[model samples]
Target: CVNCGKLKADLNDTSFADKVKHARDPKTRMSVVWNYCKTKTICETDAIEETDPDMPDEAAPVKKGHGGCGHVQPQIRKEGLKLFLQYKKT
Candidate 1:
């Protein structure tokens, strides 16, 4: 719930779509799509690292496979990185 607010407020100042594609599955090795707001979004972590968002200061570890607290898919991760690199090239 709190995380939802952060996304809506753009507190992280990052694109949600980009973050989701970077998420990885704990067991599936990136084969899960976390549905945020009825949208199949990539998962992210509580800690807003260089690859993560600027979430709450004291966020908890996102549960794996839940699809809410930052459980992203493998394909998304690959796609995200590709797009990121492409953008950087330009």
Candidate 2:
């Protein structure tokens, strides 16, 4: 994840977007985003649109995906006062 430096989770209006909307400052917004992203188990992937080879202009609607590093995500834990990453089989 650090190597690619990409967010593990994709943004959505249901949860992440709604929480960020009420954040009053950048710091608060950052935490809000981080909290939502940290729990994701896998990295987001790009959606592939299926197009008709015969009809070049015809295509399907966008699928669910994004441009993110396809890497396993680690869970962040707060143990007492120390913060660490917990890795397990994903």
Candidate 3:
């Protein structure tokens, strides 16, 4: 990913499900997922558990975050036979 290095979308995530549903082929699907993942800067956060009406005793499984870092993506730059990673501010 461009920012976060982890996959924030899972099967239970609607965002991921939507991408999967519209995929034409496996290769294209992977590309689509990658493109989307690369554009996202923030990672997913854990959601609060909710109890279902049908199963009052058991709360629905809470979604876990991808635990991605909040740092900016660095770019490689070279000048005068020197190489360095340049991090741009948002």
Candidate 4:
């Protein structure tokens, strides 16, 4: 439900919706959502220096040696956001 909450919050913000409108795929849209979540959680103690700003916060905290799960969660979250938006528009 966290992802749904995040998506709704983003959708209510005109600027955020505008930013994501050009994202044609789940992967690309996930990047936008991920970056937004990261910015909301950023703190001084988070060791952000080693992480790429463009990487999702979920993907950032992990070390380089670990293999990521191919971003399936992000794709799912993106789909949820799209569905919610479609429902809202109608």
Candidate 5:
């Protein structure tokens, strides 16, 4: 969820809106937005370290990719839908 946190931070910054406005085209703008909003996977070691020490490894929610992060997947799907709509508009 680090990337999602960063995206929220970037979105909270007013400068991000200005940058989006200055983007040359819809695709470029979407690219900039997507860069901030993409899903990132936590490595196994980091996931383990961040998890509760008392929790068993089997019980700990650690998966190799975006599967572990439910929050990001919906954001990504929403973005993809938006991009498709944008493309359709043009």
Candidate 6:
């Protein structure tokens, strides 16, 4: 699995030891099944469901008045940022 090696090395480089650890553990790594399947499969839904799936597909603006992506979500912003930086570095 070339991609697996790349992902591991990339994560290690980015200091995402936790994600790597979880992904490597036998119990939690099964979650990768979702990622692999999601990559190869597509989901189709009705027009109405597609139009609005409870939440917007895009990240809402960080505005206090509008109750946008706020404290409720406790954004994992750093995790994504680290992965992004690793991807760019590679």
**Residue 83 error, candidate 4, Å:** 29
Per-model TM-score on C-alpha atoms:
0.16, 0.60, 0.47, 0.35, 0.31, 0.19
lDDT agreement of model 5 with the native: 0.48
Error of 5 at 70 (Å): 11
lDDT of 4 by residue, 1-90 (tens): 223232322354567778789888999888987776554421112123565677888865453321212221222225644733212221
**1-90 per-residue lDDT for model 3 (tens digits):** 346555745556677878888998999899878776665544654554556679756455545655555555556578989988766677
lDDT of 1 by residue, 2-85 (tens): 334323212243465455546665543223323333343344444443424566645745533322455333222256447321
Q: Per-model C-alpha lDDT, please?
A: 0.38, 0.71, 0.65, 0.46, 0.48, 0.33
Candidate of highest TM-score: 2
How many collisions per candidate?
A: 6, 0, 0, 0, 0, 0
**Pairs clashing in candidate 3?**
none
Higher-scoring candidate on lDDT, 3 or 4 = 3
Error of model 2, residue 62, in angstroms:
7.8
* Residue 82 accuracy (lDDT) in model 5: 70
lDDT of 2: 0.71
Candidate with best lDDT: 2
Ranking by lDDT: 2, 3, 5, 4, 1, 6
lDDT of 2 by residue, 1-90 (tens): 654777665665467667888898999998988777766777766765667777655354555665777777676789899989877863
